[model samples]
Target: MDGKRVLLVEDDSAQSSMLQLELKRRGFRVNAEKTVAAAAARIEKEIFDAVVTDLRLGSGDGLQVVVAVKASQPETGVIVITGHGSIDTAVAAMKAGAFDYLTKPVEPEVLALALRKTIEHRDLVGEVRRLRAEVKERRGVSGIVSASDAMGRVLALVAKVSSTDATVLVTGESGTGKELIARAIHENSPRRDGSFVAINCGALPEGLLESELFGHVKGSFTGADRNKRGLFEEASGGTIFLDEISETTPGLQVKLLRALQEGEIRRVGDNHPVKVSARVVAATNRDLMKQVTAGKFRDDLFYRLKVFPIEIPALRTRVDDVMPLAEAFIKKARVRTGSPATHFSPAAAKALRSYAWPGNVRELEHAVERALIMAGGPTVEARDLPPEIASSAPAKRRVKAKPPRKSRR
Candidate 1:
């Protein structure tokens, strides 16, 4: 604060003189005002790093200074000083946008420290806003990286549903980017700053999954030593993405349904229920409705989770995006693997487009990574692709384009 300017407003002449002298000695430029009107007018015409004012100004209020400072320069910090027993009035000043409050008999050291903290905090908040804006510009719509009409429609739905509090169910074949879609919705939603907890339901047994979702009390079961907060609690204001949701048992489905309906979860071995507000976004590779019909899944839970269903198209179906996605993957994979390849050869493009990619987008990403590692030149050739994709190149692209007849016209 070597050259930082401060505005001091106090009706008491001697107190104002002492405070201004001490602030100047501590390396601040101080401007003294005898009333609230003078301070507010100065704030309107100029900018200061901070303002120090008495809670009770003669025939005027210190809150007027705070209002003036905030209206003109919202980033400026305000500090209010009050008598020893006027904490209530000081708190009211704080509610009016004062940065800090000091009771009477204010020490110069304490005021200096408070000023420094307030300015530092202002700078930190500004930087955070700048960085968040930069990220939003760089990654459009959560960065799904697709350019097909089919995928475009899916992205449109994602954009629409992200603004509301809705339970989403994403369905597609394995490796068709279901989880990616779920994450896109969460990142674009209002709860983006909150926790994004994900887990694969099929990866855990029924008892373990129960404890993991709702938590368990200490000594609830064998090896239970301490109380644990579960994923639902961790995702209190954000999203919880459950993958392979079809794999959950029927009993677990009943509990999940209750949680959805009641906005609460009962921890294992605990009678009390804890409130939770996490948005659920579940993904599955199977026909959930079919499972419900066959009695393998709970019908009530199925309907609850499918409030906003999104079905991702398989990779082979959006053939128009194949080459574009391959190129994008190459940009990332080449940096990771230190590959010399820069682009795909015509033969390589044909192989990528013709093959029925059963494994979908995930498989395409891995294929590009593998090709980049195996390629020897600047171009990725058909032979560099996986055996299944390399041998399935279509016959049409194999033939050269017919050149225009010489002078036929």
Candidate 2:
């Protein structure tokens, strides 16, 4: 057969034989097993592209087969066939790493379609893993530290979009690593070998920002002495990361829209247009939609920048990642300061997770750096944490009390 290798685990002899024959007729190299133990033995000795298993076997539950296949070959797809199918059982199967769940007496065509979809899903996952490994080997993760599912989803989206020349808009709080996301995109994109020019639109005045973005000709202004290349020109054949894009003035927004739409820019004091080839990746902590509604941002520019919108979840929502991020920061801090502090104490970890990180990842990083400096031993204890974090409590809203009424009233 020219199709994939599949292991079919069904307790019933008749059902198992029927499935094996059907799968073989469909071009799959099928191995039929009547028990979970037999399936586990086959998985140990051979690799499969997919596994179709009965949820309840004669000897044991089919979840054991799913676990074994996943443990041995994570790329293998597992589809659970359950006679007693319920939402809870389906959820359990999925949580146990089944690719999909099928109810009892599945139609032959339906089973074939499910197997095809599972194999496709497996291939897609394998491709993502391969791309991630390639990216790590060549360009590192660009210092992006994330272990939470929220960020995992973000990274997956990032990977999928990196191969395209789409304009990306990343929205998050100021210290939530928006620039890091931008860098990761650039590093994994076709423009990896080219320059990645980043400029904060909110960091400069209107006049200077224009000059810096679109370049300036000789004597373009009082301070302009010579012709200078703008960020767009410097980023030709690469990417330009515009941070705090909501801060751009209306006039500058028009220029940005022109560049994004026409792929051309005019230098200051020069009427000649220069063609530039650069991908735009913009970021903002402010709400661009609100800015558009408030007449503070150009609607066209907002649309141009948001071709692919990626919102980063604030660190507070992913508290589970706090300690791992803290540990990573500590490792980097040790390299910078040659400190002996290597880890966080249990109490310190608790304090880190408990605090409301208003400043997000940047705040956590700074806290770790400061704690490393304050720590006198190998580990950072709760006492080493900043008082704001160590003594932090959930924020409470104040309710104003009414003034007491006079008795005469």
Deviating ranges (above 4 Å) for candidate 2: 1-139, 393-409
TM-score list, all predictions: 0.68, 0.63
Tell me the tens digit of each residue's lDDT in model 2 across 122-236: 8888899899777666454646777899989899989988999999999999798898899889988989888999999999999999999999999979979999999999999
Residue pair clashes in candidate 2: none
**Candidate that scores best on TM-score:** 1
What is candidate 2's TM-score against the reference? 0.63
CA error at residue 181 for candidate 2, angstroms = 0.5
lDDT for 160 in candidate 1 is 97
Q: Write the per-residue lDDT of candidate 1 for residues 126-230, one digit (tens) a residue.
A: 999999887765444645777999999999999999999899999999998888888888888999888789999999999999999999999999988989989
Q: Which candidate leads the pack in lDDT?
A: 1
Per-candidate Cα lDDT values, in order, are 0.90, 0.89
